[model samples]
Target: MFILVGITDLPWLQKLLFVLVLFFYILDVLGNIIIVSLVMRDISLHSPMYFLLANLSFVDICFSSITVPKMMVGFFIKNTITLQGCLAQMYFFHFLGCTEGILLAAMGYDRYVAICQPLRYGTLMRNTVCIQLVLASWLIGLTTSLVHAIMTSYLPFCNSNRIKHFFCDVKPVIKLACADIHLNEALLTNVLGFLSTSTFSLTIVSYVYIILKLMKIRSSQGRSKAFSTCSSHLTVVSLFYGTAMCTYLGPSSENSIEKDRIAAVLFTVITPAMNPVIYTLRNQEVKKSLKKLIKHEHL
Candidate 1:
């Protein structure tokens, strides 16, 4: 069995964090569920962009769900997790995290098609194409995470089994292994770096094309209208990538564990909770659909 150090050692702080995190978890689940339901139920949202957004929301919920509730339970309990359980947590966390990264890139490409190649958007981002993109993302994520989990499971853990984080994240868990983990560390860095860098490059390249296309539009209104459609996606990408890079790609040290914990909260807990608000507030179509749903319920 492995013990989780959790977010804090303070009794008072644990209680406080438990309540705060629980509230956010509930909000995250509810908000994402609403987005998914809205996309499926509303005919107006039956488009490639909304289809991707709904999938992103679903990823956010699952990603956060994998870690947050377990962390919350640790706040008030012994915080012990078995070896198998720890491995499972680490696997799914990376699985969803990687999937979200790829999905964001795909979404960026979808926006690029919608904005830069509007004439061919229908042909490029057809429903079949969007479905394939999502499936590819999931498959890639699953394969990468499976390798990490299997490799880590082989490491000999003869030392202390206490993981100094709220959950069984790769870095913290690997720190407990008695065997030489240079290979493990290298794998973690290379695999995660490749996934993050490649997907991020795709997203950035798509946005670069989008921005250049927007620049050529003579009318300010037309440019703003085009940019508005992409703003929410950009915001979400920023939030996710910024914190994730810090946690997985930054220089590692004894002191860095605390920083990793903080970064983990931002990407896992905070980002998921914020996604629904960011999309709904910035997305006119989503807001319109929500309002119509409310008005219909009243009638």
Candidate 2:
């Protein structure tokens, strides 16, 4: 069993943190569910873009669910997790996270095709193609997460089993291992790093092409419309990759645990909660659909 340090030691602060985290977790789950439901029910939203977005919303639900509930439970009870439980948490955490990363990249590509190659949008981003992209993302995420979980499980944990973070994150859990962690660290740096960098690169490249296309449009309104279409996605991507890179790519050491925890909160807890707001407020189509749903329900 491993004892989690949790977010704070002060009883008063712990209460405050619990209330705040509960609020955000509820918001995250409900907002994502609403998005998923909207996309599934609304015929107008049955496009490649919305399909990818609904998938993203679903991933967000699972991603936040993996850690937040456990973290919340730690507030009132002893923050102890069993060996198997820790590994399972680590597995699903990375699985959903990696899947979301790749899904975002695919969303970027969908936007790129829709805006830049309008004529080919229907043909290029057909239903089968989008389904394949989602499936590929899930397969890749599963494979990578399995490797991490299996490798970390093999490490002997004869040392202190106290995790410095609120949950069983890869870095924090691996730090408790008695065995040589150089290979584990290398895998974290190389395998996970490649996944992050490659998916991030894909998103960047798609946006680059998208921006160039927008520049060619003579009408300011055309550019604005195009930019608006992708703004929500770009915002979400920035929030996710920014915190994720800080946590993973930054120097790992005892001194950085606090920083990692903060970064983890941003991506894992805050970002998911904010996604629906970002999409709904910025996206006219989504807002309209939401309003329609609300009005119809009242009748």
Candidate 3:
């Protein structure tokens, strides 16, 4: 049971944030939509990496939708959200968040294959395997989210109803409970730690292998070409995991609420919008496809 007070204290500042966030939401949604369209419509982009990129685009769209719309509404209205609504939001936020983390690792592995084992990549990450991996990420995300939601639902809120943060996250929601929440907090810590650490570790390992393989290339142009494609993925991985580590991987109490809120905004709001930009800028195939898409629409 909680009402979201949101981030700013001043009404004017809240209005400003609303406008800014609304723009971000629009950009995030529109950008992901374009990415999905480009990946699907372009036959040249029909590969394991683009397939996963499309999946990631869909995930980002859903992930940002879970919070940004509601958060923007809070600015103009009374900022009241029922307990049930809050729980639902919490469920989806974590669901998509966890899925994105796992998906990043999957994408890293895809990259490793493309760079390190170009010949066998087709055999290794066939269409069936790619579909299975995407399905697995969703299934794992949903199951983990359900467990977290159920565990959090059992906590006694008593009369407490005010959530300090803009969204209905587990950490902020659990802070309002009158009953003991040590178990809940511990569970959160362990679950989040495992999720972030395991996926991030995989990403790191994939990249390490990719780099080592690239170093073995004697041709400077070959190394440059290979590294260019990987640079976008690496940049995205760093952005997503860096902000996530700041928000979830640390001692929660060590960071102030303001800092935590800022970190949340970075990953939740900004990162999704940035993904398409990163890919489109760095990826020649994507850019070419997007250009054709634009031309097609104009025609």
Q: Which one wins on lDDT?
A: 2
lDDT of 3 by residue, 229-258 (tens): 889989999999998887776665624555
Over 4 Å off, model 3 = none
> Where does candidate 2 stray beyond 4 Å?
none
lDDT (C-alpha, whole model) for all candidates: 0.93, 0.94, 0.88
- Each candidate structure's TM-score, on Cα atoms with residue i matched to residue i, is 0.99, 0.99, 0.97
Q: What is candidate 2's lDDT per residue for 102-159, written digit by digit as tens?
A: 9999999999999989999989999999999999999999999999999999999999
For the record, the alpha-carbon RMSD of candidate 2 to the native fold, in angstroms, is: 0.7
**Model 1 stretches astray by more than 4 angstroms:** none
- Write model 1 residue lDDT over 239-270, tens digit each, in one string: 99999888888766778888999999888898
- TM-score (C-alpha, index-matched) for candidate 1: 0.99
Model 3 poorest 10 in a row by lDDT: 249-258
Task: Provide the RMSD of all predictions against the true structure, rounded to 1 decimal.
Answer: 0.8, 0.7, 1.3
Q: Candidate 2, residue 261: CA error in Å?
A: 0.6
In candidate 1, the residue pairs with backbone N, CA or C atoms under 3 Å apart (3 or more residues apart, or in different chains) clash, namely none
Candidate 2, lDDT over the whole model: 0.94
